[model samples]
Structure formats: structure tokens, C-alpha cells
Target: MRKFIAKTVEEMPPSGIRKFFDIASEMKDIISLSVGEPDFVTPWNVREAAIASIERGYTHYTSNHGNPALRRLIARYLRERYGTSYDWKTQTIVTVGASEALDLAFRAVIEPGDEVLVPAPSYVSYMPGVAFAGGVAVPIETKECDGFTVTAQALEAAVTPKTKAIILPYPNNPTGAVMTKEQLAAIVPVIEGSDLFVISDEIYSELTYGGRHCSIASFAEMYPRTVVINGFSKAFAMTGFRLGYAAGSEEMIAAMVKIHQYFMLCAPTASQHAGEEALRHELDTDFAQVNKMVSDYNRRRTFVYNAFKKMGLSCFEPRGAFYVFPNISGMGMTSEEFCHKLIHEKHVACVPGTAFGAAGEGFMRCSYASSMDNLKEALKRIAEFVDECRK
Candidate 1:
């Protein structure tokens, strides 16, 4: 039975993030700041729309590319928000969250021996996604001194003849780093005049604190080669809905759709209906509720960043998303050891930065997505643990 398993599937490393989570789950009195999903419930209107869709008998399979109404609304959302345009009918394919969209995009474009450049301290999925598509995952490490933003020099140095794509995850997950227009512009020359595709995962686009999110696809040169991966989970508090879509050139999207058609058939019928309502109802109204959620997250973000500084931990102030990566090297322990001890001894849980990449060592990712009360208590426990470890 063991020999029957595929080598790739067997050899892949188990998720380091999940290892701590599983331990914390069985423990008592643990304050978890490891999970990344928003603690907020879905907006009432979106939930109601899904209920209505079910009542109206929208439970059957939809078109392989997803509902036209949802696709068109997504296109409009992109245009209004990012000032980018794509053919709703041919250039967008709604899948089961951005996770599936990423897989489909990689499978559609990658071949054996191709190389996909991924920035380090990234979401844990990108590397495995590339490998699952029979492509090599090349990690270009970004540092805290540089604010974790990838530059053209680093990107160009990593590119080889086999380079086929690049995974750009901004408003980044563990680091919570956001790339501004100028930052993105600096990398344009490296991508321009090349055949490399840009898989820009902007799932956290709406949660930026400094300014509006900038899409790589907004640039003229990058647009033709960029596949913008976005979803309802992060922005609308719809994680369980598992709804996301990809936008790209007609040819690329068509290829992805073919893979999606056979692999997933279609995204959930009710989720598609709910997604449309999210855009048409909440988003069209200037995102009143969504804006409120963002405000709350900002408050938590500030509190957590200040708390880390007060504790003498060196951490970059995150400008987007709901995480803070605090350097833990001074604690004289590996990130995994620190996290394990913190949870077991202090009853607080945070993900080790090494969960993201080897470059993330000496750091720990603490999500501020929990309530203020929870965050305050967790920080207090963490402070006690830090002090105890100091001596």
C-alpha cells in the first residue's frame, strides 16, 4: 500500500503551520493567533442571497466557467476597483477559492522542467502548487530590511531560460507587506520583454491600510501576462464559502477553464449567487460593512504592532492584512521551539515564520484577527513568556 502512493505526494513536507495548530487544538486554555481567516461572520445580505438561491432551486451544477451574472459582476468589480478590464465571458473562471484557481492556472500553463519564481516568506501553498504542476519552485528571498518587497534586480537575477511564471502574493499573508505602485513599477522591467506569466494573488487587496490596493495587472505591460487571483474569503468574510476567481487573457483563461471544467466542473451554485450579491449589494454601496471590518482590523493591527515594539521585539510594521511578523531571534531559540514553548507554557499560539519559508526563520507570525480581548490577553501571556526566556 505504501509503494502505491505517488512519490511527489509522499515526499512533500507536511505543513509546519498545521503541526502547531493540531497540538493547540487538543490543549486547554490556549489563545490561538495562528489561523488567518477573519473572525467576522459573512454579511447578512450575502448569507440571505445564498439562502434565497437555494430556495429558488439554484442547487444544480452551473456552467463550467461559472454563472455569467457572477462573472460579469466580478469584471465590473475589477474595473471599478482596479481600473482593469477583462472579458467576463471568456477571461474569468470562478473556482473553489483562490486555492483552486491557483492550481488550475499552474496546471494550464506549466510543463515539466518549467520554473516558477516565488517570493520567500510567502503563502505556504505557492511552492507546492508549482510542484504539483510539474514545475520547479524557485524561491527569491525578500528581507525585512527591504520591507519584504521584491525588486527587479533580485527577480532578474533569479530568472533563467526555464522561467515560465512568477507568483506575486502581496498584501502578503505572514508578513502582511503591501507593495505600492512605485514598488511594483520597479519590477516591471524585469517582467517586460519576457514570456513569463505573472500569477498575482491579490486576495487581501481590500484590506490594505495605507491606500488602495494596486494590481500588477493595472500596468499595461503586465496586464497581458498577469492572472489576477482574487476571492470573497478575505474581503467579505466568506471563507467557508470557498469562492474565488481568476482573471487573465482570453487564451490563458480558456486553457484554465478546460482544466477547471473537468477537475471541478463548476464552483458551487449558491456560492456564485452569493458572490454576485456581495458585489452588487455590499460593494456597490461603498462597502459600508466591509469598511467597518477593515477599520476594526486596523485598530487591532496597530495595537499588536505597538505591543511587539513595547516588548522589544524587532518587527516590521505591516501595512496590510491582519498579521505581524515579529523577529524572535533574540529569544535564543528556533521559531518552532519558541512557538511550541509559547503555546505549551504560556497558553498562547502563533505560527512560526519558518512555516512560510526557510527565510522566515527567527520570526513568528501572529495574526490579529481575533477579538481585542483575546489579543490583549494573548499579548500579556506572550510578554510573560518572553521575559522568562530572556534570563
Candidate 2:
């Protein structure tokens, strides 16, 4: 019997989210706030565009870089939303969600054993994807004290002789903490003189509240070294469509597209068209619906924060995204233990913060992406559990 496995494949552990989701599946009567997707459907115009594209028999693959129209639309979308310009022909590459874009970016740039910096409590893919591409994942802890902003000092401390790139996961996952322009500028000087690339995962770029989202790519000097990874999943509730795009300098975009060409060929043709339509027509029209969701989430955020405060479990007030990463060290339990017990005993399903990284310990990520009704039920269960634990 052959038991051959690559060292990289063997070293990789299963995702923490999948582990908890799997455990929750066997538990009965659970109210889960562990999901990471938006609760809204893809808006009407976007759906129509996809269907219309299909009806017109645009079923085949377009090109290695995806449909030209979508690329240009993405350029316009980025420009209008973040005030960044990406030349459609030379700088944009559509991908199979942001997932493939991440893979391709790593493949394009990472050399074997090259050091890649990743902040704690970030999206799960950065580490494994970098490792699979033969890059070392250097996990840096970004504490809640600084609103999860990666400071220039912290970044400078993490960089080494072998460091090749840094993953900036903002409007960050499982934290909902956003970086302000001032905070973003705080790290600019660190990379200004370096040869390292910045792989900014702006997946939740549009979900921001309070201030407009800023792109690291907006800085002209850093522009050449920045690769912007964003998608339709979080912003427009188009997860199933699986369309995302990356924009960067010509050399880097072309390098990424080379891997994308041999690997994915093209993103789903229909979905790409729908996404183009999403950028062109539905964004402004759907802002009301999008804002409604944001407003609802803000209300839910206040409720959860207040409830937790009464229970003596204060968490950061999330500014963007739909997650609340609460430090539950006061609960006197490991995050996994707390989450598992909550699922089985209290009938509530929330993810252990350690699912994001070691620095994520002593906390739990409760997402408000699910319905408010579910949130209410989960909070009641949580209160009951808190009372029982206290006793």
C-alpha cells in the first residue's frame, strides 16, 4: 500500500471553521452564529444579467483573464468605490472567487521557503495557501487593543531577510475591526523602501460602516507592489456566483494571470457578466437594500454588545464586516471548550476565535451575518449558559 503524501499536504491541518461546523452538524437544536456569509440574496439586476448572459448562449469560457467587459467594469467599480485606477488590459484579472486569486497570487510570487507575513485573526486561507506554494507563513498577532490594525512597528518587527510578502486582511474576518486611513498610513513607511509585496485582501471592502473604505493600492509608490484581492461574495451577497478579481501593476497582474491561465482558464462566464452588471447598474440601486442590512446589523451589534456587557463579557464594537470577536478569557474555558459546550449544552453554535489563529485564543467570533431572529434566540441561550456557568 502506498502512503505517499507531500510534506506540505501532510503538515496542513483542517480548517477550524470546518471542524466546528462539522461538530455542530451532529448536535441537535443549535442556534448558530458561526457562518461568514451575508444574509441577502444577489440583487435583481445582477441575477437578471447572469440569466440573460446564459440565454444568449455565453456559456463557453471567454479568455484566460476572463471577459474583457468584466475587467473594465471592475476597473470602474474600483475607481468609483475606492478612487483607484486599474488599467483593464494590463492590471485586472478575474478569478474563481477571491479564493483562486489568493492561490494564483502566491503561485506568482512566493518562492520556496520564502517568508510571508500574516496577521492573526485573519482569513484562514493565507497560511495554507502560502505554504502550499512553498512559502513560510509567519503569523503575527494583531490584538484587539489596537482595533486589529497592523502597525508599522509591528510589521517592521515581523519582516526578516527572507520575507517576500504580507497579507493585509482588513475589514478583517472574525474581528470586524477596520483600519482607518490614519492607521493604514501608520504602516505605509514600513513598506515604502522594501521590495516586499503587499497582498491586500479587501474582500469585505464594501461592508464598511462609518468611513469609506481605503485601499492600500491607492498609494502610488506602493501601487507597483500591491495586489488587490476582492470579490462579490461579501459585498453583494453573491457567494454562489463565485466571481472575484485581482488588480495590480502590469508585471504582477500578468504574472498572476499566467498561473490563472493554466489553472482556471476563466471564471464562470455568466457570473462574470452578472458581476459586470452588478458594478455597472445595481450597486447604486441596491445601496438601499445593502444599507438596510448594515442598519440591521448595527442594531444587532448594539444588542449583542449590551447583552454581553450586562453579562460582563465586553467585546470590540465592530466597525465593518459582521463579526464580533469577544475576549472570553473571563469564562475560564478554552475557546474550543466554550464553543463546544455552548453548542451541546446551551444549543448555540459560535466559532472558537482560535479558529483564526493562536493569538485568537481566549476569544470567540460570533457573526451577525445570520438573521436577527436567530441572533435573539442565540443570545437567550447564551445568557442562560452564562448564568449556569456563574452558578
Candidate 3:
């Protein structure tokens, strides 16, 4: 059996994020913050749309590219919001989730031994996805001092002739870091010089605070070479629907659709109908529901940041997404050790920073997407645990 297993599949480690989540699930009275899911239910309008779709017998498969209407809406939404344009008919693909869109992008572009630059402490799926696509995942460490952004210097240093593309996980998962337009511009020259393409994971795009998210695809020079990945999961709280999309050059999307057609056939038809409704309602009402959720998340983000500060932990103030990455280095334990003991001692679960990448060694990621009461209780327990560690 062991000999029959593909070496790559067998050797790859399981997700570090899920390991603690599984452990926490087995324990009683645990306030698990290990997952990055939105606590809110999918907006009523979106859910109702799915119901209507099912009633209308939309249970069958959609076109391999997705529902034409949904693809058009996605293209419009991206262009109106980010100043990027795409031809829905030829430059878009609907995937199982942003996760699949990511995988498709990797499989579409990568050849054996090609390198994909991943910013460290990024979403866990990235490196593994690259590996599964037979590409080398080269991690470029983003620093706490630089607000967890990939600087031009670091990106340039990591690139070699083998490098084919880079994954831009802004509104980053563990760190909640976002790149401003100016920050994105600084790296354009390097990307242009290397002739490398980009996979911009903007799953948390709508969850940004302080300012709007600036997509790299909005840059004229980069737009042609960038695949922008996003979906309904984060903003609309539609994770269970398992729908996401990718938009880019016609060539890139054609390649992705070729792979997606054989592998997934299409995203769920009912989900695509729901996604279309979500976007239509958002556009009509100016994103009223999504804005409300973002506002609530902002409140939680502040609470979490302040709680960490009061507990004497060094935490970067996150401006996007719902997670906070706080440095737990002073606790005299490794990230895994600290997380393990905290969950056992306080019954409050968080993901170890090392789960994200090697650069996350001294940190831990806590999602603020829980209810206010849950967050309040979790923070109180965490503070007590911090004091106990100090003693």
C-alpha cells in the first residue's frame, strides 16, 4: 500500500490549520478560532436565490465556464470596483471555490519544476497547491516590520529563472495585511522585468477596512498577466455554497477552463444562481448587507487588537480580513507549544503561526469572525493564559 502511494501525495503534510481545529472539536467547551470562516449566515437574499434556483429545476450542470449571467456580473463587479476589465465570455472561469480556482491557475500555468513565489505566512493552501501542480513553492518571507507586505526587494531576491509566477495573498489570511496601490506599484517593475505572472487571491477583498482593496490586476501592465481569484465565501458568508471564480487574460482563462472542464465540469449550478443574485442585489442596493457585515467585523477586529495589547502581546493591527496575528514569542514556547497549551488550559483555540509558513514562527492567528460574546469570553481566557505564562 505504501509503495502504491504517489510519493508527492504521501509525503505532503496535512493542513496545519485543520489539525488544531480537529483537536479542538474533540474537546468540550472550546472556543475555536482556528478556521477563517465568517460567522454570519449567508445573506437572506442570497440563500433565497438558491432556493428559487432549486425550485426552478436548476439542479443540473451549468456551462463549464459557469452560468453566463454570473460570469458577466463577476466581470462587471471587478471592473467597477477595481478598475480592471475582463471579457466574461472568454476570460472568466467559475470554480468550486477560490481554492479550486487557485489550483486551476497553478495547473494551467506551471510545468514540472517551475517555481511559484509565495509570500510567507500566507494562506496554507498555496504551497501545497503549487506542489500538487508539480511546481516548486518558493516562499518569500514578508516581515512584521513591513506590515507583512511583500516588498520589491524580497520578491526580487526570491526570483530565479525557474520562477514562473507569484501568489499575491493580500488581505492576507493569517496576518490580515493588505497592499495599497502605491505598495503594489513598487513591485511592478520587478514583475515586469522577470516576466512572471501573478495569481492574486482576493478572497478577503470585500472585508478590507480603512480603505478599499487595490488589486494588482488594476495595474495596466500587470492586468494581462494576472489571474484575480475571489468568491462569495468570505464577504457573503456563502462558504457552504462552495463557489468561486477567476478572471484574467483570455489565454489564461481558456487554459484554466480546459483543466476545470475535465476535473470539475462546472461549479454547482444552484450556487452559481445564488452567486448571481448576491451580486445583483449588492449592485442594486450598493452592498448594504455586505457593508453591514464588514462594519461588524471591524468592531471585532478592534476588540481583538486591543485585547492582545492589554495582555502585553505584540500584535500587528490588521486592516483587512478578520484574523489577527499576534506575536507570542515572549511566552518561552514554540508557536505550536503555546497554541497547544492554551487550548488545553483555557479551552480557547487558535492556529499556530507556523501553520502558515516558516516566517510565522513567533506568531499565532486568531479569527475575529465569531460572535461578540464568544470573542469577549475567548479574549478573557487568553489574557489569563498569558498571565499564567508570565508567572
lDDT of 2: 0.86
lDDT of 3: 0.95
Cα lDDT for residue 381, model 2? 89
Clashing pairs in 3: none
Alpha-carbon deviation at 389 in model 3, angstroms = 0.5
Off by over 4 Å in 1: none
Each model's TM-score? 0.99, 0.96, 0.99
lDDT (tens digit, per residue) of candidate 1 on 105-165 = 8998899999999999999999988988999999999999999989888899999999999
Candidate 3 C-alpha error for residue 139, in Å: 0.5
The TM-score of candidate 1 is 0.99
Candidate 1 overall Cα lDDT vs. reference? 0.93
Error of 2 at 183 (Å): 0.8
lDDT per model vs. reference: 0.93, 0.86, 0.95
> After TM-score superposition, what is the CA distance of residue 293 in candidate 2 from its true location, in Å?
2.8
- Please provide, for model 2 over 1-391, each residue's C-alpha lDDT reduced to its tens digit, 9 standing for 90 to 100: 2259887888788898878778778878877788788888888888999999999999998888888888888888888878898899999999999999999999998999899999997888889999999999998889778888798888999999999899998889988888887787878888775577999999988778788889888887778889999998987789999999899989998999888888779899999988988787645665565667677777887888777777778688888888888878878799999998888888788899888889889989888887778888888889888788778
Residue 389 local lDDT, model 1: 94
lDDT of 1 at 309: 95
